[model samples]
Target: MGKFFYARVSSKDQNLARQIEAFKKMGAADEQIVCDKESGKNFNRENYKALKSALGLRAGDVLIVKELDRFGRNKQEILKELEYWKKREIRVMVIDIPTTMIDIPKGQEWIMEMINNILIEVLSSIAEQERDKIRQRQREGIDCMPVKNGKKVSTKTGRPVGRPEIKKPNNWSENYEKWVKGEITAKKAMENCKLKRSSFYKLVNEE
Candidate 1:
């Protein structure tokens, strides 16, 4: 039986040093540990998939993670993965969940299983809820951003925050005046301004 460790962080900018150190402290060799700097929302991470490959884990082998959420943040998906490991007889030991780290006597294994299930259920739910709260906060922050003309603007600089607004062509005023007097078609005005249909319409609608 082999022991394998997995570590994860939400983004490439985040550090995996702490989790790696924890694994090393537990006597896990570098080669036995795989780390992924990817979101915990899904199991589609590269290093994570490599760790779960057939050649990596096997029956009676142990898979260790620093925390339950390090395994994943989606509660249902996390539970599904745990069921997969259980069916394959691969032990998953989460360091933060102490009950998962204990070895149970053969006959009373159910007791440990029950306790571990309850703990995992609660922790995974919390993890997923935390992810949701983070996303909600991000949306709120974006929503609170000041809008300028027709775009979101930075409160500090009063400049657009997202895609830059398309500039009006130099001849826009002349052509727009002609179009307003019914002397030129809107399409003809757009052609004269050298702007695309959507760009011309967008500029026209902007105050």
Candidate 2:
């Protein structure tokens, strides 16, 4: 019924203007644009959760993104959502990486769809792997930087500050591992944690 656009920037210092411009150029209305000033490596963001909950998605609704990575760094999560939206007859368009859209008749060969789905899985897997690699390299680089009396100098803030902890549900880690091992149904997990089903999956499927 409506067109939705999502844009993300990893931190407060980064601006969403470029992505907003790109989405507007794609004909997305101001009201339809959703911006998340957070990391895509984690999907449990307030803005992302809001968009999913709104589910303004119907048969012909479209989801537009500036790039595929903007969707998320986690590949399996991306592929899962893509399949979910497709089943709902929602179209997702990534401007930077097109050709992700599949055009299939009402009744067609499932094999073709399966093959395309596999490609999405593979590409997303690669994206996740690359993200991990980048994180590892960043950690190494930070470690190699000169330290002053056991404290790393801050180039931006000019004051030594510890990396901020990402707030997560208290039992998220334990619950997620347990759910993955089939210790509990997703619904039971959510009930135990007082979270939603979608939140449970988002935590469990985290990279």
Alpha-carbon lDDT, every model? 0.90, 0.75
Q: What is candidate 1's lDDT per residue for 5-35, written digit by digit as tens?
A: 9999998899999999999999999899998
lDDT string, candidate 2, 1-207, tens digits: 678999997888998998999888877888899988887786888877876675556687888888777788898778778877889887777776555444556777476566666666776787798889989998886776666667776666556546532345787778767777999888877877788666556655564
Q: Number of clashing pairs, model 1?
A: 0
* Most TM-score-accurate candidate: 1
Please state the error at residue 104 of candidate 1 in Å.
1.6
Clashing pairs in 2: none
Error of 1 at 107 (Å): 1.2
- Candidate 2: which stretches are off by over 4 Å? 101-119, 155-158, 161-207
Top-scoring candidate (lDDT): 1
lDDT of 1 at 115: 91
